[model samples]
Target chain A: MKGFKTQWSPEEADRWSKEDYLTFVISPLIYFLLALGAIWSLLLLWYGWLTLGICGLLLWLMIKIIDPKLKAISLDYEKKQKEFLEELEKIERWEN
Target chain B: MVSFAWLDWFWLVVFIVLMIVCGVLFYRLGKRSLADFFLAGRGLPWWLPAASVYATHSATDTPMWVSGVIYKYGLRGIWYTFFSAWCAISAFASTRIFRRSLAYTQAEWQTLRFSGLGAELLRGWIAGWQVFMNMFVLGWVGMAMGKLCHYLFNWPEWIGLMLFSSLCAIYVLAAGYWGVVMADFQQGVVAFSVIVIVSIWGIVAAGGPQQIMAKIHSLGESWRLNPLAFSGWTSGDFPLVWFLTMLVIAVIGGFGMGTSIDWYPEAQRIQSARTVRDASYSIWAGSALIVARNSLWAVAVLAFFSLYPRIQDTAQYEMAWYRLGFEFLPVGLVGFFFAAVVAIHISTISTHLNLGASYATRDLYQHYFRPQATDKELVWVGRVTTLILLLGSFLYGLMMKEITQWLIFALWIMTAGIWLPSILQVVWWRFNAWGYLASWMANLGLSWLVVWVLPEFRVIPSLPDYLQFWIMMVLGALIYLPITFLTRPEDMNRLVKYYVMSRPLGWWKPVREEAIKRGLIKPERDLIVGGQP
Candidate 1:
């Protein structure tokens, strides 16, 4: 537990970058759109927009609800980890 | 009936020799510990795992399966594979979570995240089912490769199965995860290049892409290009609604719920990634490759339709890609093409063998039997388990005749049943071992009732495959909820530990508060006013 860390270490969150946002945000959006657009186009081509529209609307709703929560939870956890590591370091210095 | 040229043999021999050499180089690396054997010491760069993930999905039968779907339904048939685009959820959400869990296997994650006898039971259950699923996949791919050998050389299918099983087992048993990844990298590149090349050849043979499109246009079967166009219910091809239903299941059920299902080998890759970012990128990169590969196959099948317009038999339709390989590839390259095909088979089989043996040695043997076994003893157990699993899969391959039917059950039906439970395990704190077990059992029994028994009895209208899967998913939820509430909750300490460690962004309000009080973590920036309750 003393040295455990994740790629999104809390110590770096204060210095989060445009690149981080782009990688975490734009990249996934572009990728999913490219993948899902193939399906959407196929659906529209064969079954019309009614089917595609319904799916698109539902997916939009799910993403809207889920995305912010995922971001908040990740940030919260990283912040806690940062504090936890600092606490451990303080204890070690006192013992010395 | 395709015959390989001498150069094909030459390429295959070379491929095998190089693969064995990789096995020997990595042999010492794998002998260190269970982690080294199963997870490559978590030392792989992103691209290696990315390539290995792509290679694992490109089993020998993948092209045949794609060709068959296209022959029946057109290019839209690509949707069937792309349905796994649900993996996009994995790339986004679960990659970091999986890395943070720090569990050896998905089964082992239960102990990390849960508590007491219930977590133990849950661990054993997951480990057992995963082992069974891995063996079945290994055998299914082995059978397909054996049949391909028969198609190419008229050799006894068993001989080819034996050769494949023996060679793969020797390397995989010796070198473990290092061998699996390195071999997968080499094989994935060759297999990908060969498929693309052969497909381009087919396109040229049919006077290029424009001519193939023109030929399709002349036939007035443009419906093939539309991914959503389904033949009517009685036509055997799924209907339009079924396609939509599958999309919903793939997205909502697959992503919104348990994005991290028991894709055991893929899970190993995620764990093996050098960083969490590497794990995330690997999934997206691998999926992009799969998408590219599917498109290439679709184009090849389109050309096949243009060249052989009258071959309508289903069996011949499925084998049309192979026929194209034989007809279009030149003598010297024909062997190279066949070798690439063998490479695909070996990559897939090797991963399954290595993954399955890990589950047996770690979760089953070590956990229950020799909890204090030395690293040397564990690696020995892993090697023996690899050989035994390979032998079992070889026999299973021999007995299977209809590879497609078994594949459907393995891929869709089995997954649908377990999907909900897997999701709940991560997100919901109250979901205990009994709840998971009941969900699995209920999905199995109810799925049989819907897919098989009801149809046989004509109790109601026989549903389409997609409908049946969705219904079972709903039924799984119904079964899980009651069992979870009725069962006692897990030990609270374990719950808090998992909560703070994994930090799963779900319904863990109490655990977070407790973690703060215990000095496990500081309060959040936006904590409630006067938060120390």
Candidate 2:
């Protein structure tokens, strides 16, 4: 009876939510690499060096590593917000 | 220097009488209760509140600053104002968020959201900072009016400040927000009249608007297009990275700061609306005033350039314009301009004092100091605090050695500090209280350290100053977010009770249902308000 109506468990949220994946798991390891990559990329662009390929990779890394979410609200804005807040509230409730 | 003749003084007396008469008229217009005092008793229709916001924001400093910025930098200041125009529209579009909280002040949203003892304590201190800054602005406002008066009539500086301060104080004391609201209409008319007359007079003085623009454009490309060019903190012929930082701070960060204060007058105005549309319209309409008032001042600034092309100091350039008006305006227009100055001063100062006292008395004192105080007592506290704030502000001004760069840094950007993270917390889900607090502290601390230590360390980065400011903001947010997630958003449950009362969560149902019915994520919790977290 509860099929669709059942509340999301913390495990389910952690597994399915993109924010959980992007924020918790992937973020820390990428932070330094991204900033360094941007610097390298810019230097390569100026030199017209074959090294530009690595520079491109670094610059792309920097842009991705920055919280793309804060740039502007995404297309799935309201839907994502609802899910995020719910997952957050659930997380808060669990800690209590 | 043109002086105020007897006729000019007579016109000034007449304008004062009109403000007092309007206040008296409104007092008798069934506005005697507490509602009458603040939020115009929440009964003001859309146009009245809208007009009030427009007029109140047009402080004596508005035109003064405009004249200064234009004469110094050309159209850059006007271009930047459009950024604020975007902010106003952004606030209007986000009405769903601002109106949902239904609190008296933005700080109330903090207490409402995080209902823990710890959060409330944090709330009180943050609230105190806002009240202090609001009052701090009030002190400067008094000083501004005093200076205007001395320029207008050759009155003693202290005498002018006294007259402006006492008038605003007595009216605010007599009618509270009620006097201010009605006085707002009178002031708005006077301000608009002055703006119209001044613009016309200025154009005629400069030959014509087209001629004025042409003369202004002749200065140079740097004067014509560069926002950072006039600021003088630039690299070799170009503004350094700091200018880029200022642009970012003024635009992206400035939006957040302005939005955070969106609902400052609180429940009074919110409750006044017959519908949500009315409430939103009230503010949007108020914003419309900004468009014209901005243009009015910009025109005056252009006029200044046309009239006097080579004064370098920004303040001197602006003073020369106002002095020209006093020296040259017709007797009738002189009265209007004179009245407009007082009108601008009263409208702006009254709102600041009321807002400051509201923060100190309602948000700080009532929320923390004496939570159980009666309504009458709270009202008395608010009124008393207003007087105390005025005196305190004047004293602070008297004691200052000079407004140091640090003071300018804080004064210009503290609104951004409080605003950016606070607004971002709602829009950016990764944001948490810890992140908000850390970024808030870091921005101020780093800015302070930059001033104190940067002068010593001498680590000039590859980027310009403006760009450096942006990098710092980005860095601060980066540092804060991880620390926030590490701490957990779960702490926000402290505010759950208040959230439930205002906007109960749909338990992710809104998202899942929308997505699933449309074939995306699986449906989670159904549309049950309190079904789950």
Candidate 3:
């Protein structure tokens, strides 16, 4: 929370930043933990609960870090989407 | 053999009708245009495609595959299923980039990414290959269903294959992907709920988790409980080296397109989402559900191992999950379980039917044959291709017995050598189309040599799969990297357009500078100056 950027302008969000890299690391760890945690917890193992608890915290942190950037990117990108769609159709029809 | 009660028949009939009707209800929406039929007009919020992703990947053979591994290798075998974890990083990376590109299929993305003759050739080759590959997949998955039905009702395998696939094609023909996604939602729920219920029943049947653990411990196999159990560093089947290779392939693969076969269908789902964020979350959440689901099955298989500890035959133990449902669940609930199997079976069928049709219609017919086809005409073409793919699957399914070995070789050819080139094409601005094409060609010949031909001739020893991957990657780079530097780069104009639109990550400095010079995107310095952060 301290180092991660919580707010982003459209242009700033368009570039790759530390938030993206942090997510690239965090996302896979959550997947690994979720798999191991689910099985271990189903067996009623205590460490399984601890693993899952950590996974939840990591997931929340990942979202907090990346969601604002994504929101900014999506908002700005949608405005140009119509023009892009038109160009795509032209390419599809070999008119480009 | 299992016998169905009247109530069981009642459950099966009602569920089949509900699934078909749920899909057909979207008929009006699907017929509105080609986009509606193939992509639900690109308006889905995230959850719809998320459920579709989960349902599509959870086929009839999935439990069998999971059961086989967990039974043979215990908890360590979960890594085999972890290949889907590619979506973990992909959700934030390539999924975002691909969503921005607006390409309907990966084949089409080739032409968008590269220019001129080589790009056209790549697009055509990939499109044709995808059409064939989807048919092959349909056959593979359909035959798995056929095998399951034969095991259950003593029906001929062909009857099981043809009957269910034809039934699923009804909605797919009427509604296309709209039908596939909607039916997948219901089917995903049914299959997941029943999986949970039956796994719990199986665990209880083994006298609960505590008892199961006690039995395993008493049998002197406590290592089975350890998820991190390694046989040795590199000698045994569950080697640490293999695990590290799998982690690299599954996680780092997210940065590239087409790193796995699953990327093809997922590309469609990525585009169907309403926004980049929606697309990202859909892929991430869908795969999260898959990872969670595999854990449930892994534990259930362990329970089965505890109950019947010495099933030496692979075929018999592979039926562990299905046996837990039919051999354990009550009479009426057994029927409900069968209905869920049908749900599982056809959800996969519907997705492939529609997916194969998308490649056939969008890439082949519309782009190459009739580029000016009206939306209405394209929608009809989609239906016709859907019918063609369904019939083609039936033929492929019937002949699968003889071709199974060859199909495995074909899959290896697609994956091992082309993996890095796929990543480079996405992340490196200078990875021209010829380089990518050369990798595919080199992999085809080298896979045969390294995997089979040389080994058969005693020219080299049979290597482990992990070793083969690294060797092929290095060998493929030998060919493609030189070809990349030799050939002219993709036209700067096309690269700039793609860069501005997709904003791809990694090694894109030259293209970014050009985009900045052209005023297409603001410079980083300008952004910082204007932002007041």
Best by lDDT: 3
Task: Quantify all predictions' global Cα lDDT against the true fold.
Answer: 0.71, 0.54, 0.91
Clashing pairs in 1: B8-B335
C-alpha lDDT of residue B421 in model 2: 66
TM-score of each: 0.85, 0.72, 0.98
Q: What lDDT tens digits, residue by residue, belong to model 2 across residues A26-83?
A: 2222222222232223223332233434534543443353223222221223234444
What TM-score would you report for chain A in candidate 2?
Answer: 0.27
Candidates 1 and 3 compared: the better one by DockQ is: 3
Fnat for the candidates in order: 0.03, 0.03, 0.78
Badly placed stretches (over 4 Å) of model 3 are B401-411, B529-533
Candidate 2, B230-336: lDDT as tens digits:
44556443354444444344334322323333345423454344333455456555654565456556656666677777777654665644655675688666765
Error of 2 at B336 (Å): 2.1
lDDT of 1 by residue, B1-533 (tens): 66656777898799888877877689999888878899998767779999999999999778878887888778767777666665565665556666656566877777767767777787788788877878787787888888887877788888878788688777898889888998899989998998878877887888876677778888998776555566774355767677676556555443333332335677789888765556666776786678667767777787899888777766677777777887888888888888788888899999999988888988888887777678799999999989888888887888887766676666666667777677677667777777877887887788778888988999968887887777888888888889889988877787777776666645667777888789876666533322121
Q: Chain B, candidate 2: TM?
A: 0.83
Q: TM-score for the first chain of model 1?
A: 0.35
Chain A TM-score vs. truth, each candidate? 0.35, 0.27, 0.97
Backbone collision count in every prediction? Answer: 1, 16, 0
